[model samples]
Target: MTLEVMARCSAAAMAALAVMMAVGTDTVGQDTETVKPDERSKVSQYGIRWTFSEPRRVGRFVNGDWWVVGPATVVSVTPKPGPAPEDEVTEIKRNQFGDAAHQDDRRMRNGSMIVIKSSGRQGYDSRVKSYDPGLSVQFPRPLKPGQSLISSVSHTSLPNNNFSHKIMW
Candidate 1:
């Protein structure tokens, strides 16, 4: 093989290796799956709550953040649904560190926020008195079996404030 040809081949091989390293492989055990909470609880690290209602969807974000989605329920309640068809609520919990910052930055840059609202009779009657991070928000009243709650968060900053006036959900 000519020296020039060998050099070109080596360069191509190196490029391929660089790309592979950039996109690392996912190890089965290394990837943690999001699991629905058996009951209503707060994830202290991220200041998010896990409300497990019917039909749970648990998985890690693309960035390896853990989250559980189910019906939004009241934390004060007891003996709630657990891995049963009868459960019909869902809440999403993101517990990974930096997830909030990344989400917040994305929302802020995009000039949008995520609003999570409640559903059913419980949501209509019960209001979210307050919300806090790393703590569960206490409800004035217990959520009914089929009720849900919703909340929203928006990004605070944008580049050049060009899209500041625009609203994003």
Candidate 2:
């Protein structure tokens, strides 16, 4: 490559590195703030509609990072009705991490944040798989066994949001 092209590439990489370092240093030692008792105890509702993936059952399972001290229960899961069952499929996975697997257990339980992840992986080309316009969600209270329901999740990417947005300096 020419010197000019190499110089430009080097500059861009350095800029990205600096951003990561600054952001990493700021949050390295901090902990997720404690959430109020009311927030954890109360129930909220949001309806979601999106294509989802099913993970293969491995072996034994354990309570993961997203498990809080609440009475949360999954009612049911059904495929989208009609011929086109998978109009919005993203991807599928072999391992089921469970919700909140990426966050700390304590923080996920009693914190203000909710961490949601896609079951499947996205393709190399980001634009081709844009999951349509969107759908409104109503995340409701925990359900009972007798009650029947379907689960759906939605996610969107912010421009240039693949990396940390928080900076230290």
Candidate 3:
């Protein structure tokens, strides 16, 4: 190969290596913050809890930090019609990590925040003639083994207190 061509090729390879190294540095410490399968809790509604056998990662932010929590079974509560059905109640009761699972959609209970990660029947009552109310959730940190988690069923809404301002000309 010609000297100039070899120099250009070498420069291109160096540039590629530099890019890879930059990305590698960004992910260097990610594994330590990651939640292992055993570190994740077996969370279920009605207070059933356990750890996962396979490691799982949940959410990832735009900056690349991952949600360090379980990829276990997450059941979300859906809006129920008048005279809530048994299955509806059961689904809500099964969302052990509702608070962590529903952080994105702002699903709340009492004064606490609850969010769901799954949608469709995974988080709602199929029999209810209602729109889907599932949410996308993201947990803040890794959960310990056998950690106790619960879903929030009671929903509280802010009262409409917007007052109109009058402009006098």
Candidate 4:
């Protein structure tokens, strides 16, 4: 088509779009509205804000599993270093953590203990039933071009495993 015809068609399309938009929103918006954030995700399992430091690509695993596996640090917004036990170490409390590591355990701002548990295969929570510890060379899930291994989504096991063992005096 000629340039003049193309320009007329474009102008006509724009005019039609404007008309549709005007017709769609007869009931407009309010001037002011109160907004609030989601309360569910406000705090992490540690009873405080926590996140993984920006992980850099160091290289993949030998078996071709992960693209990177370098030293990742846990940055605690409010790192509460638990007081060293002056008294003799009693029966190391396993109730406050997922794994039975006393030395790696620390308390939170809300007096809740945070235990560091190493993830087993591919971030699969070891405590759960049927988990792949990252490297899945054996039972590889058959995925399409746009598909992925859903079971491969490994989330770090939260301290106390979402249950509280707080003893009330």
Candidate 5:
């Protein structure tokens, strides 16, 4: 088509669209009621936020499960952490089978912990069921709204099946 004809057709189509949108808005807005900010429901508020730092690409497991760790802060509005709802917690207990030196049974809530959230396997040939894409350090202690603790993930399991009680910086 010619430039003039195309421009006219485009202009006519835009005009019609504007008219339809104006009519639709008028009809839809008539039945709507203005909602105040204070009147909104607060049930969805958890009062906790996680601020993650730049992730470092840590070494990958032999099974092709790549891992990354970074410092994180857990900001909470209230002293007591949000109520523990069963639906939010995924309990995965790793039982010690053999006579391993590391016998410490750790829980996430007991103290500061590192939570690894993954997006699943990145490669099809990976032996691991999921991939450890990223991890964040969390504090069990309460934190004020503007307060944050300096924490990061560390590997305790040492070389040759040894374990370190203290995590070196």
Candidate 6:
């Protein structure tokens, strides 16, 4: 065969080999398939309880599955006979977990705690206002003889299909 013809045939053979390698046919396992239900409930036995020493100004129990739009804070006090001091304020919100798709947990004073599991999203704006069993709080703190206290709990679901339950008293 002429040298040019021989070279052309060799090039064509190499091209076919490259195509075959790109479309690999190696099967690593059998074709058997099995599907399972997506069961995503985490809290099987969850509970929250709080105790106080005195009473002070109270607010409505804003209950819901809240998505954190910005930072949040919490305040707690032993409740003295006089007016509640401002020093009792406890900032809460620095203890969040995950990057754009991660989970985190946080604890706050005033008998409040939170578990944050988030898959980050830009301009995320979604919240729910309802009662859920996973987010329940029992206040045991004793108010003054005539004073009262307020407690609030919140629960939320993350973008990654995970749920969070928070309680404050």
lDDT of each: 0.23, 0.20, 0.24, 0.23, 0.22, 0.21
Per-residue CA lDDT of model 2 for 2-60, tens digit only, reads 22221211111110000001112213235755332222321222332211122111111
Give the deviation of candidate 3 from the true structure as CA RMSD. Answer: 20.5
Q: Which pairs clash in model 5?
A: none
Worst 10 residues of 4 by lDDT: 11-20
Q: Give the C-alpha lDDT of model 4.
A: 0.23
TM-score of each: 0.20, 0.17, 0.20, 0.18, 0.20, 0.16
Better-scoring candidate (TM-score), 2 or 3 = 3
Could you tell me which residue pairs clash in candidate 3?
41-50, 42-50, 45-94, 101-115, 102-115, 102-116, 103-115
Comparing 1 and 6 by TM-score, which wins?
A: 1
Error of 6 at 79 (Å): 22
Each candidate structure's count of clashing pairs: 18, 9, 7, 6, 0, 4
After TM-score superposition, the amount by which residue 10's alpha carbon in candidate 6 deviates from its true location, in angstroms, is 71
Q: Give per-residue CA lDDT, model 3, range 1-169, as digits (tens).
A: 1222212111111000000011122233755653222233232222222233444433333443223243233322222112233332222111344421122222222111122232222222222222234421223323343322222232222211112112211
| Winning candidate number (lDDT) | 3
Q: Give the TM-score of candidate 6.
A: 0.16
Better model by lDDT: candidate 3 vs candidate 6 = 3
Model 4: what TM-score? 0.18
Off by over 4 Å in 5: 1-28, 39-74, 77-107, 110-118, 121-134, 137-169
lDDT of 5 at 106: 27
Q: After superposition, how far is residue 133 of candidate 1 from its true place, in Å?
A: 22
Q: Which segments of model 4 are wrong by more than 4 Å?
A: 1-31, 34-42, 45-48, 52-124, 135-169
